[model samples]
Target: MANPDFEDLVETFEFLDDWEDRYRHVIDMGKAMPPLEEALKVPATKVDGCASQVWLVPKIADNVFTFRGESDAMIVRGLIAVLSALYNDQPVSDVMKIDAAAELGRLGLNDHLSAQRSNGLRAMVERIRETAAAAA
Candidate 1:
């Protein structure tokens, strides 16, 4: 999908004067994520190092990569939404060039994140990049 959702998220965060509002917005994004099929929720797709269970399935077609993910926790699911905005349906070249931590910093989410959340988020990024590398 051609997700323009990240631009909306950035604009919404800029409009909100407080981290509380941004956090709420993130949670809302999580609420918007499509439900993953139970059949795709296998151990191999699970993201390790996350406090909550996360499953990611990546697909490549016509030189573009797309992802589907889900998380048990709302905030983590929001983070996955952020990833979808950043990574989904992108060319492998674009995906390989991204600095996920830097992009997440643009969202201003990391400083407020708990240590575990931050670590899990980074783990997700690593997984994405690794998948991108293999696809490339």
Candidate 2:
């Protein structure tokens, strides 16, 4: 099952008629996220394989998983927001069980994103899964 917040995002994507509008909505979602602390953007948090600079900081509390991330590019930042919705506040077990590729595909992102972006997204998902597995 997807996060309730992610389900809301899917609903919003469905409401938008055009890709341009949906793209803007994604950017708006990124704008709505709080900026990650500069100190937290260190090497350990940095996600490799992305064309733009990206960092993800994960936190697990009592078996619930959560993360915050940032990217140098706006679109990438928006992508991070989308990932946050997909994975945040989930139980560690549930986090590992999520099919991120399928969930993102529901938004038609797989068809629209560039190859580089797709790879980067995959990298982020891998990192999240690894973190969750470690916690579990």
Give per-candidate clash totals: 0, 0
Per-residue lDDT of model 2, residues 13-124, tens digit only: 9999989999999998888889999999999999999989999999999999999999988888999999999999899999988999999998999988999999999999
**In model 1, which runs have C-alpha deviations exceeding 4 angstroms?**
1-4
Give RMSD (Å) of candidate 1 vs. truth. 2.1
Quick one: how many clashes does candidate 1 have?
A: 0
Worst 10 residues of 2 by lDDT: 25-34
Tell me which residue pairs clash in candidate 1: none
1-136, model 1: which lDDT tens digit per residue? Answer: 2246566667778899999988988889899989899999999899999999999998989989889999999999999988998888788868888777777787898789999999999989888899989878
Q: Please tell me which predicted candidate would have the highest lDDT against the true structure.
A: 2
The TM-score between candidate 2 and the true structure equals 0.98
lDDT of each: 0.87, 0.94
